[model samples]
Target: MPKITYITFDETQYDVEAKEGATVMETAIKNGVPGIEAECGGACSCATCHVYVDEAWAEKTGEPGAMEEDMLDFAQDADERSRLSCQIKVTDELDGLVVRIPESQA
Candidate 1:
């Protein structure tokens, strides 16, 4: 399992262990992290799981797919680093990854 760090808009941090192949949104929810509201589950149709990948971990997390990109338009503060946590798969390479949850989702 890879440990992912989720930081809320207010700077509260939750470090959770993510199973390989599970999405970041799933990991957050499993750990009771408060910011991610994965309304559509792991489906890419909703942007409720929006999060900002820390700059240092961006490349490792990779870019969003076309469908995910389209859905991100509904997210608040969508930016180069913005991604739906449900779209991010956990892997050993993502250990120690840092993601920031937006205030809008809180």
Candidate 2:
């Protein structure tokens, strides 16, 4: 399992172990992390699970797909580092991944 760190707007951090093939949003919800909403259940149809990928882990996580890019238009305070947690698949290379939850989602 990979370890993921989720930081809320107020800087609260929740570190949890993530299954190799699970999405970041799934791991967050399962662990009771208080930032990701995942309202579309990983369908990529909503921006409720918005998060900012830490710069250090950005290349490893890769870029969001076109569909996710479309949905991100609705995310508050989105930027180059913004990503929908539901679209981020977990992998061994993602161990120690860090993501920040925007005030909008926190």
Candidate 3:
């Protein structure tokens, strides 16, 4: 299991150990994190799982795929760091990852 630290715009933070292969949004929902609403379950159709990966951990999470990239155009504040959490497959490399919920999502 890998631990994910989710931080909200208000600076609230929560840490939880997640299933080895579950998406980051799944882990956030399971831990009752304030933001992160996986509206489309683990599907990439919705931008509700939008999150901003901390600059320090950006490379570790990698970039979004074509579908996710296209979907993100509808997000509130799509930026270089914006990502659909449901599209992220968990891995040991993502441990201690810091994801900040944007004000729009919060």
TM-score of each: 0.97, 0.98, 0.95
Worst 10 residues of 3 by lDDT: 34-43
RMSD of 3: 0.9
lDDT of candidate 2 at residue 76, scale 0 to 100? 90
Backbone clashes in model 1, listed as residue pairs: none
Ranking by TM-score: 2, 1, 3
How far out, in Å, is residue 17 in model 3?
0.9
State the lDDT at 80 in candidate 2: 99
lDDT string, candidate 3, 4-76, tens digits: 9888989988988988889999999988997788788978887988999889988989888899999999889
C-alpha lDDT score of every prediction, in listed order: 0.93, 0.94, 0.88
Q: Clashes in candidate 1: how many?
A: 0
Candidate 2 contains a number of clashing pairs equal to 0
Candidates in descending lDDT order: 2, 1, 3
Off by over 4 Å in 3: none
- How many residue pairs in model 3 have overlapping backbones? 0
Q: Give me candidate 1's TM-score against the actual structure.
A: 0.97
lDDT of 1 by residue, 16-56 (tens): 88999999999999999997889888898879999999999
Cα lDDT over the full model 3: 0.88
